[model samples]
Each structure stands twice: as structure tokens, then as C-alpha cells.
Target: MLEDLLLQGAQPNYADNIRAIAARWEALIPPARLGDLESGDLQAGIVSILESGEVTDDVILTIAGDLASLSWWRGPPLRDDHRARLNALTRARLTRLADSLEMAPRKLPRSQLRRSHVLLVGNLLDPLHSPSGGAIDYAAALASDTAVSRVEIVHSGEVLPAMRTYIEARLGGFPASRGVALVSTRDNPDFLADILSRGPCTFHVWCEPALSPAISLVSRLGPTLMFTCADEAPVQFADVYWYFQSEAHIEKVWKAHAAPQEFIDRYVRILALPSPEPRPLEPMSRASIGLPEDAFVIATVGNRLGVEMDEAYITGIELALRSQPKAVWMVVGGLPDYLLGAFEQVLGDRFLHVPFSRELDRLMTTVDLFANPFRAGGGNSANIAVGAGAAVLSLSRGDVSSLVPDSFIASDPEEYFRYLGFLMDSPELLAAVKAEQGQHNARMRDQGLFLKEIQGLVRLAADRYEARGCGAPLSTTVFAPLTRLAQAG
Candidate 1:
């Protein structure tokens, strides 16, 4: 019934949502039929259900689902007119029912969270969750904190085996040992109740159009935060922060998105990650990717998608290859044919593409200089290569700039070439650059530092919820976009 309207780009209207509620209720509860009460009659029928005082599972769902949808209006007016139309007394009665149903929360008893029963929500379980690197780091960072009672994940229902391997290797013991649950339910319909059961969630779902109904449900939880993993998001919330790639480089991005200044002022940065053991830099050669031992290899990796950065990345590589006789480029991740063709014209046997690797550290070990793609940028791959003591020549343009060091992240395209040219001109400079970045990488790996930030964010969330007063009827998509009016019963 709702499909035709939704296909034409309509936000769910009152009639549309009421139809769904009536349909579902009728389907679920046969004997207690919603007879002819489909659209305009739904409000009265719903009110009558409460009057009967014999609530069943289906009845409560019909109420809760309707209320959640009722909360979906986004506007300058903030509150919904449909909700406001009811008399104050009727509104109070509805609010009380919501409170009783646990659809609207109140203050969390101190015992309820206990540092937290954490729920880390994200879209994918592959690659430790963030290709730009926060998900992997934050998971480890949250685990490293002794104060955080548990570490669980709500992914898009697919738990790759490598994710378990990464957790076990990085955190010692996981899933079983710590009772670290992986609630694989990012977009699942049945996941709402399970998520509501877990307090203090950190969702990787950001200010984007793809915000799932389940995610919107979690937003109503007192302690929830939206973490951005991409450059653009169509929607935002009151309690939103980002996956910090750099400590001091997010201003441009926040501005680009027209994020509220108040939100930006109180914004949290990316938490640090424990430095994974670097691939040994000693006697480095091209043997890992089966290249000649004598080659001066420059590598770039990750899902280097989108065509915007193709020109810059190819040009940087070609310049280096042309200048240095033995210089070759090894790339991983699926590159577009145009990028490959661009390389072939200027760099024949000098350019090679490696298949995607689960153990990306192995690929980093082969890179003498890592050239990060321009527009799409890098975070996870950049972290690994730099941590592995590989010298990196990264983009100054995009989100990748925030993920890399300012000292190394070049603002000028010329900087990428200059650094690559310097290394090509004097091979001796390579060791010193690696030595410097390795020291920086070691400081970044501090477990205590990462844990402190994670614990602080966790504690701050609980504290903020407390200060704001718990279970303060949250708006689903934005703050006060639609309020469920409460009238005295």
C-alpha cells in the first residue's frame, strides 16, 4: 500500500503509515480485527485498544510502530501537527502508555549500564569495519579499556572470519573469552528489541539518507552517538560525532556539510588506535609481491574507487616511474580500467596490480613509498603502511588528508611529486623518513592513550544523558522534528 507513494519520493505520510499499522495489526491479530479502520480511523482504533486495557504483543507493536513513525516528520516547526491536534489529556495518556511500554526511556539506573553494555553499530563487519580505519581502531580501543564492561558489535549481518581473527589477534581473546557479542543486525528487521536491550550504543550510521529504521529506533535511546564513515550525509542528529582520522583537520569537512556550529564546537575527534606490530622494515625488498629485488617500489591500496582521483594518482606514479629507472608501482584494490590504461601508456612493466588481501599488512611491507589516492583518500591503508615504517606520499585534497599526518599530508599536488622525486633522487633519504614516521607511529600505538579516549567518550555519553535528563522523548530523525504529545490520563 505504501510502495506507490514511496516510489514517487514521498516521505511516509500520516495516512500511509496508518495504513501499514492497520495492515500489520490485522495480519497479526485476527480475532481482534481492525475492521474497516484502515487510515483515518486508525487513531480512534488505537485509542480504543488502550481503553480495553487487555494489551497483547500485537497491540503493543501496533502502538509502538505507529509512535515511531509518528516521530518521523522533519521540519522547521519541529513538532508534528497531527500529534498536537489531540487534547492535552489524550496526549498524556499516550505518553504514559509509551513510558509503560519502554518505548520512551527514563533515567538509566546506575546498575543498568555499569560503564556500559556497549553496542557498536556499523554497516559492515569486513575489514575491521572501517576502511578509513576508525571502526577497527575504536573496537580495539574500546576493548583495551578495562572500565568498559563489554564490547559488542551490530553489523550488517555478515561476520567475516577475518574479523574474528583480527579481534583475537589484536585483543588477545574475543567473542567467547570476553563474552564480546557480535550482534549481526545492522539492517535487520528483527534487531530493534535486541538493540533496545543494549544501552549506550555507538552507531557508525551517520547523518545520511540511508539511516535505517532500526538506527532511528536506537537514536531514541538516551545514550546514542552517530559516527560518520563517509564524506557526505543527508541527515544529522543532536548527539553526533565523527570517526576522527586526524586530531585537527575536520573543520573543512564539517563546514562543507553545513554542520551546525554548536555541534562542531562540541564535536569529538577520532580516537587513537593501538599500533599493530609493523611489518619488519629490515632488508626491505620487493619479494612480497614477487617483484625484482632491485626495484624501487611505490604502492597504493584499498578500495581505491571513484574516478575523481584517477588523474592525480596516475600522474604522481608516472612521474616517479619516469624519473627513476628501477621505480615500479604496485597497487591493490580494484582500480578502474581507465586508471590502468593511463598507467600502461606511461608506465609499461613498471606498473602492477595486486589482488585484495585480507592481511593488508603484507602489502604494506612491500611499499617503499605509499601513494594515497587523491579525492577518495585513505585512512586504514595509510595507518598500516605508516605503522609498518613505509614512507607515504599522500593526497592533500580529500578526506584522506585528515587521516594522515599534516607533516606528511601534502596540500600541494607538487608535494606528492616533490617527496616522491626526493626519494627517487636520493635513496639515502628513505631510511630517515621511515625512521621518523615509525617513531610517530609508535606514539600513536599507545594502548593507554587509545583506551583513555574511548573510556572518556563512553563516560561522557552517560554523563550527557544524565544532564539532559534520561528518556527525554527523543525525535527519531532530528531533534524535536516530531514530538509525541503526552496528555494527563
Candidate 2:
């Protein structure tokens, strides 16, 4: 069955067969990088898989995870037909899942609700040690509401050392009577189900589509909120869709899935998760970093440079440097050798590659302009740059990139380059932009404001769940907004 599905132009109706083929191919050639999907053959295979099957919960989820990893801005684009088919499949699968989860309406009085005990489920790289954005978001959620009596974190994978320290600190910080624990479920569905059965708690799934099967099941237990965190589609099980990006951008994402206007209006809400406060650091000079003291420095900082920094991004830097004599490019993160070689071949000493540093805050002080490549992630770095008083330049697409002020955000490649040139040429204008961004950054980082908003959204989600009479299903055919004709089959 797998072989027949893998054969060129062969279409399969069973989703389980597509899942088998995908699993086999993944084992045969494990993707080393996100850009692996950029290969023409791989893209064709993915499109074929999407077109072949009746989207099952597992297959659609796996495909969504793969699509999320692609550098959509710099791509061998998926055809319109394939995109439409994928969307149709996604809507159909979600509708069926919603129907299956529906239960008889039974109202549980508000007094019986265990709203004080909050449960957060997701994949954290290292909540205790490494301060990844997801980790910070999780921590912030725990600290956001002092009114809550208990916080339970059910995460996948092994609990790292840092997580232990965080748990200790959280326990110490809260009243001795309160409870706090971070348990690793090891991605076991039964274990997760057991945890969910413990109490009537508000659940938040801060995960990518890959983990949807395990985490999405939370909706069956209680009021479930899924933080999109810039992941592609909304999880079908989530009652409320929480996002960090602008409302307009969130609407745009839902619209692409062909969501009905009513579905979006009722479920979508924007809330900025709190980021760690930037600590004070002594400023570093250009010469200290081995750059010309008087040179105009333009830098892009990120952890996944290999994935985000493509050939076009490099070419753009090269063009900007060649055109502006005093302009120098400094990249502060890891990159593949091929990309590094491209940088060296074009601009010799003018390009400075700094390994990921602890003194990133100090280094930001020296930069004149922080240029963000057109990519999916990097909201934290961009916010840091803005707070550090660097004029941030980005294309107005991506969840992270769209956070910049309108004047600095470019609509297209031409505008991006134009904005960069204008900023480089006029120091006065650059300084003004930086000041504007700093103000915006300050507002975004307001811990109190974020906490207030998050608390309200949680209440809102709980209210909606209660209003729906507890276990009664939320949406049925609402997800099949634009695919009703196809869904009729």
C-alpha cells in the first residue's frame, strides 16, 4: 500500500496509507534542516500526499508541521491547486474531529469549577536552563495570575536541569500552601489523558501541529486554549485561539484556512506573552567587536541563521554594503558553511560573524540598524533590537517581523532595500525611527498589561466553555466554511 501511494501520480484514499508512506520516507531520509522541503522532488511528494488522502487527524497534522518548517518567504512555492486541496483536507478533518468529540449538553455550575488550578501543556526545549521564547511564555503564564491557587505543567520530552531550578524558584516564590509541578509525560497519550482526568482545570496547549494529537485531546477535558505562537493552522480542538501577532495577521491566517467569518469572530483573540526583562549590560564599542570604529553597522541576530538567512538575504546585505561604502554587516548566530562561504566571497572583512553570545545586550548597543530577514520567527530578537534603540528594518509579513512600526516595516523587497538605504543615508531619520520603536517596545514589554490581558482571555475562554454547557461540542461544520460542496461528499 505504501509503495503504491509513493509511486508517481498514484492517488490513495486511505489516510493511514499516506501516514505509512510519510513515516517510511521520513525514516529513509530524515530532514536535517527546515529547507529540506525546498527540494523539488520533496515538494512534489508532499503535494502528492496531500492530494491523495482523505485527511486523517495524524496525516494532516504531520503535513502541517512540515509546512510550518518551510521558509515560506523564500521558497519553491506550492501550487495554488495543492494549497487549496490541503486547506480543504484540513477543514474536513477538523470538522470530523469536532463531531467525534461532541458530548451531551450538561451544565456544571460555576461554583464547582476548578478554575484556580491551571494546566499548561507543550514542548519546551529547556524551561529551567535555556530561556527559549516558549519557556519564557510558560513561566510568564505561571506568574501572570496571582489569583490562581495551583499551576500544573505537563510537557513532553525529558525535563532538563533548568526546569528543576525553575520549579524550585516557583515553589519558593509562591505561598507555601500553593502547589506547583512540572511533569514530563514523555509524549505518552495515555499518561497525558490520566493527567487531564485529574481535575476541571483551564488547559493551554502551547505546541506546534506535530504534537496536536497528544495535546489537542485536552479540549475533551475542559476549556482549552491553543496558543498558535505563529504555527500555521489553528488546532481543531482549541476553543479559543490565542496568538502573539497582530489581530489582522491572525485574521489573515484563519482566512487562508477558509474559516467562516463567524468562527473567526467568536474564537480569535490576540495576546502578547510576557518576555524576560532585559538586564542592564555595559556597552561595547565597534572596535571591541573587531569592526571599524566609525563604520555604520547593520546586523541580523538569530539562533537559526541557516534556516532563516537564505541566498536572497545574503544578496541583499551584499548589495547594501556595496552601495553604501561605510555600511558593515554583522551576523550574530550560527550559519551553515555554504551561507558563511557566500558571505566571505562577497564581503571580506566587512562581514563579521559573532557566535551566539551572552553579551548580546551589550553588542546591540553598538549596532546602528538591526535588519530582520523575511522569515517566520525572531520576535524576541527583533523586540530586543528595538529596546536597545536600534532602528529595526523588516518586511511586513511574518508574526515577528510585523511587530515593527509601520514606517520601518517594508511592504516588499524593493521597499525593504529602499528603507535600508534611507536609514543608512540619513542618521537623523534612523535615530527618530529607533526612538519610535523603543516606545513601541516598551509598551509591548509591559508585564502588568500582558498579565491583565492573559487573565482576561483565560476567563473569556472559560466563560465560553461554560456558556456552551460544559461538555457539549463547540464547532461542527463551521470549519468547512469554503469547502461545503467538497465536504458534502
Candidate 3:
């Protein structure tokens, strides 16, 4: 019997290996007779051969289960159990595989990404599913470009227990491969170890201003690329030709001195939503949210999160409520806690809160009026706000006011209340304003060509990487003054 020879220690795949011989015979023998094989010379042969090779009882039990049920060869039928086993096996093999293959991890060159794999590192302004997470959205577009072969992401914002936990969370259940690397800020030295010892490439993508010790590590690592969107001047960081829903922002950047003359000369990009045939405003839906049947709806969405210059948002809301007792104010998007707390103390009962939704295009249909109480920030959310067919009452904060024209710009609560109340009281005025907005929205739709310009900037980054290899770290010092010039200009 093979058991005698297995006792002399033969490898599993060898002809003399009792385990292989038992497997061969077990497959040949009938299912009902497999029970007999378990106890007789055949079974003993398998056990003695397995024991000689130091295979545990677990192995023999597995073989027995396979012969009995004919399912062991296929792994656990339940997906979760199967996946867990797979992950365990993968982890067990990684170190041995690395050692046996002598596959040393490669470092990302400091200069450029040309043919190298690039990992986008940043906090998702919205989850991956949201259309607005520009990082992911742009990355998806870049996937079709041949310049990139591999794109991995390291979402460090999702806090985890350790570097391993962080990597595991981000790996999103994919098996690790040699082409992917974790782009991290240096605060995670252990992650750095994991990279140098086991990774294929590494780079740090700095997403914020204000250098932290973590980012300084990128400077030490020679070939890292640092990118940030926090430049004071929009054109300094973004292409001047980017698509804007509002021409006001596009023009503002064009006039700003911080933008390169080269950019200004060719800045014709503006992305506009398609303009569908206009329709009459849908019937008032206020009755659904507990607004009185007679109450008029006035809605607004903007940087209600917080801005020291714009503390009059709550004041404007109170003014609207006082001016029109039957007015229901629906606010969408994030609101600052302090403002919310204050509003709750004053007019919380009269206000309805709806978090920001991509469905704004549809939700705008139900509103009767839109009031923008922004007292600061020159760039307005009015473009899209107006696109929804709502007449806007905005603060004429410099160039941002051009986002909506023939609209009231109120400096105080009294002025805000006056225009908002007038619009509600006069249906004729509201109708005229809404009609004008429809025309403007159509004009804006023509600006959709601007998105290609944004794509052009990304392409520029990709091309530079290819031509020069990863080059020296750009001088962060030079961009600071440029941002200041943009603000003054």
C-alpha cells in the first residue's frame, strides 16, 4: 500500500506520495465504496503518507469530507466564508511569495509619472458614488487614456485602527498586485515600511495647504508630486478654461492677475447643462412638508456651512418669516452648527431642512422663490440656483452678483425682506423673473464646451510626467505670492 512508502516521506505530487495515490484512487473508486476506503488500506495509506509529510489531521479530514461530499474541492459554497478563507490564504502566501520570487518593490520616481503608475490621494468631497467627487470622476475619465496603466487610491480620510487596517479598508476587497501602491502622507511610517518592503511604487499627493510634518516627508523622499486645490486664486490651481455654470466666475478668473496670460488668451471653456424645453412651474408641493396650504415657498442653497462675513443668513430668514407670516423657508445643503442652533432658537419651527441633493434639478421644480443671503464670497451659487427657475435675491458681492441679473442685491435684513416679500406678494413679478432665468439658463447651456478645458489641464499634467519623468518638486514658495496677487487683482 502507498501508506508504507508515504511513511518514508514522499512529496505530495510525486507518484510515490501516498496522498496523491489515495486522491487518484478515491476519484476512480465509486462514491458508495469511498466509505470503505476511509478505514481500510486505502485510508491508512492516505493517513500514513499525510502524517509523514507532517500534514495535520485537518488535511485528512478535508480529504475525507471531499470524498464523502464531493464539495471540498470547490471550497465553501457560502461566499462570505469562502472569501474569508481566500483572504487568509492570500495573507499567508504574500511573504513567502515575495521571498521566493525576490520581487523587490520599486519606488516612484520623484520627477514625473510618465509611464509610471499614479495613485490619486485625497479626501472625497463626496463619496465615490457622487458625481461631484472630482478626483474619482476625473480618474475614471483618465482610465481611458493610455498614459496611465494603473490607478490606485489611498483614501486616508476613512480612519482605521492601523496602517494595515487602513490599507485593508482601502483595498476594497481586491487582491494586492505589484502594480499598485498606497500614496500616503509621511505621518504613517509603518505604511511607508509596508510600501518599501512590499509595495511597487509610492508617491504623496498633498491635497491641502499649510504644510504639516506629514507632508514634509514628501520633500525628504526626492520623487514625490504635491498637488493642492486650496490656492487663493482659482486660476493659479485650476485651468482658467474650466467649465463654470456661471460666466461670472469665468470672467472673474480672466480678470484676475494671478492667472497666466497664456491661460487668459485661450480661456473659452464653460460647461453648461443642456437646456430642455421650458415647462410651466409644477403645482406647489408645500402641502407635503406640513407647510400651510396658503404658505409660499422660498428656498436657497449655498455656503451656509460657515463664513465670518456672512452671519446675516439667519437674519434674512427671520426677516422673510416676519415679512410674510405664511412663508415656508426650505434650506438645502450643509448648515453651520452655530447658525442652525441660532435658527432653531428663533425660527426653527418655520424652517425645513433638506441636506444637499443631486436631485436639485428636480427639487427646484417645486419651489416658488429662491433667496440667496450670501453677504460674502464673491462667487455665487446663483447660476445653478437660477437654472432651477427660481428668481434669486442675492447680495451683490462684487463680481459674483453678475451670476444673476435683474435680481435684487440686499445688504441688510430689511432690504432682503423687502425683495423677498415683494416677489411673493406679486406673482406677476415672480413670473417675469422666472421667464428671464429660463432664457439665461439656455445661454449658459452653450458653455458646456468648457469641460474639455478642464480635461486639458489634467492632460497637461499627464503629458509633463511622460516627457520629463517625475521632475523636481515644484516650488511651493512661488505659488503663495501668485495666490495673493489673484486676490488683489
Candidate 4:
């Protein structure tokens, strides 16, 4: 079946398969770096395996499992018994593969790089899963705009240089004809340096860990802007970008991460969009849900990255269920397997663990309230979905619940219970809140303010280019309105 699928031109899960294979074939060097193994330097191990006719999912998994079973230690030297076992096995396997491979090296262009008016630098290297929904929305709108000429995005995540080069070369054919191409983080410093050397504008949209480095680098480079979600002490630089802070909490950098007062004075804008047609309520089918109909349905969505288990989330659900004993907790973004036993021991039958599904709209509509008991991660956790009219309950701290009204902040279990009680007891209040939330969400969709913000940033970058005489050409049409606004003064 799998072979037939492959023959039909289905994309193989190549990278994931390679990682496992590398771990198994740990021959003194990292298996991942095996692509560097030189049989006269013409062919890499990964290339050899892929080109080999005998390749199958089962074969690869078996090979990787065998390799993994033999090793315990990581890094360069092999002193321990486990390391020796892994190293000996790995070398033998690679030698066998090298003897079998008859193909010669293929030469390719380094990268068919293009330049863009907007250079967006992201810390996320994995193209498939970097830059969250918000970032992608911003990128799509900026690139799609008829006014803007070009956009180049780069990404990296444990990917090989050959793969990175290949993807970037393919990116040369991406849309946005007038714009220049910018580099995403491709793990190759030479590639990054090349773009920086050639490009006129750069904007680093950073999340948490990226904040400090982004700030430092932008300051050093002289023509860069750092936009971050971190709330630490702000670094003085050319400009800072912030979002509309909800009344729930405050950050230290609110005042610090700022552009010059002159820049602020230079532009003023207003936004108003036509009302969108209303969407109707989706019907709830109880049997479709596993839990009892009377049960309080607590739902949460997350990536499962942070250290804290969002036990406070468990507590929130428990509290709600206490008020209504039949309550069942439906969780998306599956919990860690290790913690599953513990969660079962505690929450027992109440916990319903479900893998993260793309059909979130249906799930959100089905749940009583969308709970985001996040202790970590950047940006407003549930804002986008909640804006789409998914009833949300989240932490008052940080960006997650910021846009939520004061009435929505659940500092303690008791406060949460009261709110939950109020929600259940008063259908009118629930309907009104959902309606208001829907309106706010509609505003978000209509404004496309983030795109305009990026445009503004691009203009700032262009002015910097002009000052430096970089002459990196940009779209005059996009910024024409701003120019007019200035001249009208």
C-alpha cells in the first residue's frame, strides 16, 4: 500500500525518517550529520538511502529502532559500553551502504535568491511550523497586497543545508513580482550574511527567547526594527512595536519599546469597516460528544511545550465540574504520555484526551467555554479563536487573556466558579458576551491592521535605506498615501 502511495507521487516523510535512521546509525558522528559522510564526497548517506530501491517505511523504522536500542550516550567520544555498541554498529551499516551506492554527485545552484521590499526575520527555522497563525496572517496579507511588490520568508528547524538550499532556490519562484526576496533563518550564516549585505530593509518579528537577541542585533545593524511579545526591560533602539494591551495586566516595556516622538507625530490614522453578515449558531449533537449531556464540558487547546502541565487548567475544569458533577474535560494537543497515568489517577473518567485537530471551529462551538490555562508561550493565547466567537477563559497574566474584559479575568478558582455559575445561570449574559466578542472578532478580520503596520514598518526601513544611500528600490505606490499625508501638512 505504502509503495503504491509513493509510486503515485505521494511525498515521503523523509526528514522524520532520516532523523530516526541517523540516531540508529550513530557511527562516531551524529547520524543527522551522516549526510556529510563522504564516499569520495559525491553522495551523502541520506541521498544514498533515498535513491536505494529497497527503501520502505517498515525497513527504515526497523533500522532506526535497532540503532536506538544499541546506544545511550550522545556527543563525540565513545568510552562507555553503550556508546561503543552504537558506534560499532553505525560504522558497519554506513560502510555497507557506501559499498552499495553507485551514484555520482549532482551539482546545483547555491540558491536562486531574490530580494524583497520587506525583509521579515524569524527565529523559527522550520518553514512548515514556524511563525504562528498571527505571524502567517501578517505575512500573507503583506505579501498579497497589490500595493506591496515582494516578500521573501526563510525558516529552519534541524534541516540539512542541502535541503535548505533546495527550498530557498525553489522560493525564487514564489509570488509577489515587484518585491525583492529576503532570507528566513536557513541555519547557514553565509546565506543570512548574503541577504543582509544585499537587502535594504529588515524587520525581525520575535517572540520570547528571540526578544533579547533581536533587540541586540537590530541595534547593532542600525537599520533594523525589533518587534517582540516579551515584557522585560526594553532595549533602546530605532523603534519598538507593541499591541493593544487589555486591562488585565501591564508590562514594563509598554513605555520603553517606542519609536521617536517625531515618528508618532508624523502619522495619524482612523479605521472603520462595513459590518459583516452574521453567522448562525451551529446545532449541538450530544451523542457526537462522549461525555454525558449534563456534564460541564471544559475544553483546552495548546502545543504542550511548557514545563507546567497547566494543572491550574485541571483545577479550573475540576471547579466547574464540582458545580456540575457530570462535567467532562476534553483536551486537545494531547498531554505528555508520561503524565497520562497521573492525570487518569487524578481526574479519572472526567479527562478526555484528544489529539490536536484542525477542526477547532467545530470543537469550539461544541464546548461550553474554551479554556486556555496557559502558563507559558508568547502572544494572546486564545485571542484569535475567541475573536471568532469561541467563548474563551484564560489567564489574566501575560497576553493570553489581555483583550478579554475585566469580567472575564479568573484569578482564583472561586472567581472562576462564580463566572462559570453566572454563565450557566444567565443565558442572556452568555449571549450578550458572545455577541460582543463576535463583533470584536469581526473588527479584527476587517481591519487587516497588522498588514498596514507592516507597510508602515517597511516605509521606515526605506527611509533608513535612503539615509544610507542603499538605493534598494521600494514601492512608491504603497507609501504614496503616507507621503500625501505628510505633504498635506
RMSD of each: 11.9, 6.5, 23.6, 16.7
TM-score of 3: 0.45
Q: What is the TM-score of each candidate against the true structure?
A: 0.67, 0.80, 0.45, 0.56
- Against the unseen true structure, what C-alpha lDDT does each candidate score? 0.53, 0.62, 0.43, 0.43
Q: Number of backbone collisions per candidate, in order?
A: 9, 3, 13, 13
TM-score of 1: 0.67
Tens-digit lDDT string for candidate 1 (1-489): 322321121122234555565456555543443453444444555445544545653354345445434333211111222232222223233333333435545677554454444444454445433531344545666665554556665555565677666655665654343435556654565665665565544433422222234443444465655565434322334354645554244555555545435345545775455445444645435665678888888877765332334456666667678888998888776655555676667677898877567666766777788777664446667767877668876666554554445556676777778877887777678887777776766666676776776555555666666655565654322233224432212
Candidates 1 and 3 compared: the better one by TM-score is: 1
Q: 242 in model 4: Cα distance from truth in Å?
A: 2.3
Best by TM-score: 2
Candidate 4 runs further than 4 Å off: 1-116, 119-133, 158-175, 180-188, 196-199, 208-215, 218-222, 230-238, 246-286, 292-295, 309-313, 337-339, 345-348, 374-381, 411-414, 457-489
Model 4: lDDT equals 0.43
Q: Over the stretch 29-139, how does candidate 2's per-residue lDDT look in tens digits?
A: 335422334444655556555555444456555665554334232233444445545655555555445446545654544432434444454555554122334554555
338, model 3: CA deviation in Å? 8.1
lDDT of 4 by residue, 365-391 (tens): 656666665442323335535644556
